[model samples]
Target chain A: MIKTKIWVIVISLILTVSAALSVIIFTLPKKNVVAIYSDGELLREIDLSEVAEPYTFKVEHGDGFNEILVERGRIRVSFADCPDRCCVNYGWYYGGASPVVCIPHKLVIKAVNSQKDDFDVVTG
Target chain B: MKTKRIALDAVLTALALSVFIIEQQIPLPIPVPGVKLGLSNVVTLFALFAVSPLDALLILSLRIGIGNVFAGSVTGLIFSAAGGLLCYVTELILYKFLTDRQIWVCGVFGAIAHGVGQIFAAVGVSATAEIFIYLPVLILCGIVTGALTGSLAQVSVIKLKKVFPFLPFRRKKEEKQN
Candidate 1:
């Protein structure tokens, strides 16, 4: 009986926390081309809207990680030496609910818009 | 006692590893990565109660090591190893407080702890806090799966002791009367 109650409490807590988190994550400001940092150094500024030509860049940062991405209109991480390979599988997420993530390598390619709209990727 | 326990642990680890591998072949409907049913945990729970704590640890380590190879991803291994270790530690703590019949509580806490560990790993690896958005969904899944696996472990233990009257957990102590 106690165990059941504990489970109930735990489930409710997780549900409550998850619901609040979803609201925060969804309502939080969003941006396209918010900011780009490589190896703790700012790389060339990215203009998501004006991207017309496809290009690839090599990013080796804190860890000796190799990353290659084919970015044209929509930026995508085409390849990475990271073992997880989640980012590679995420495949060109231009705009969506969540960011394309590669856990093994702390690399995030976010969609940003310069025109201040409803969401500001980061609450600045 | 030590050698017999080691042999038993080795066998249990091999069985759990096989289950872990077989489970991977069954794909998930959720697109999110690193989520699993972890049915192999049933065996781990059994080892925890039926065998010694060290034996259970051995089985868990072996399962995580071999299971990752079959999953074909090093990332999964990292997530599993960290999560599994955290869960095992929590289970050990809970096992002391809860009776054998109440093992389900241990399971629930272990599952939540596992989720927390995975999220911690995800945040560290991805370098993006935005991934935190998935936590709610993952937590719900964890509860459901954790409860299911916990119940499965409970039923297995109840039934096994019935069939194997000679099981160590039920063995009668030898008397030293004159």
Candidate 2:
């Protein structure tokens, strides 16, 4: 049986590492330009600054579809066929940090500088 | 072979699913997605300690399946399936080394594994590295929630073992004493 002391150490270690990682992630500079991605390909680039009217569109994959709503300076997944609408929950992405991700639809909507492009995709 | 085992699995599945459904009704104070009490995990931990691995697996899948039907979208099922499997496997592996008192450790492991697994699935399906930015947030949430659930499971394991001496957690020697 694993000792309580060992677990205590493990827990403390995890807590420390998580805290450090969070700090690093939060401190990173927030960028501009909301990019809509499907299956790792850059489907559309929406310049948040140039948006005149909000619009809705669908990103269709082999399995299902996600209806995305783009506003003046943000983006959101309005509807989805996947069981969990995580992307939808992403709400209005004003871009402090973090992107809205939909696993089933293979979608990621994030605010990054127009030049910051390169996605690390893991294959099944 | 025993009717009791079947009944137990069914009950556990129901319990986990209800916990899942109820959790959704409660408003999330945190705006971020995928953060919750994860109460159903307590039941899974209980089953892992009280029953066999296969039994625990059965309860887990049933909970995920029913949970998806009642409260989740298909996309959620995919993420949960990936995350939940990782959580179970982490706990199952840790079971061998952990003393009964250290079950919470398993909880922490399961929590981190869940985050990592979901991230992997998200990255795979989306085929983009951009989602990686959410990793730190997810991992931090995992540590907090895992500790809470792990501690709860630890308490249940300690008390339940006495009430049901037939549970797999009992050692052959301890069984004789009881």
**Chain B TM, every candidate:** 0.85, 0.88
- Per-residue lDDT, model 2, residue B147, is 83
Off by more than 4 A, model 1 = A1-7, A19-31, A34-124, B1-4, B170-178
Q: All models, DockQ values? A: 0.21, 0.31
Q: Candidate 2 on B7-78: residue-level lDDT in tens?
A: 878888989999988987877675445666677889898888767678889999998888988764887888
* Clash totals in order: 8, 13
- Residue-level lDDT of model 1, residues A5-75, one tens digit each, is 56568667876887677567556454346344554455555655455677777777656454555453456
The digit string of per-residue lDDT tens for model 1 on B63-129 reads: 9988898788888888888888888998888766555565666676677667777887888886888
**Candidate 1 falls in which docking quality class?**
incorrect
Q: Which predicted model would earn the best DockQ?
A: 2
Compute the lDDT of residue A38 as modeled in candidate 2: 92
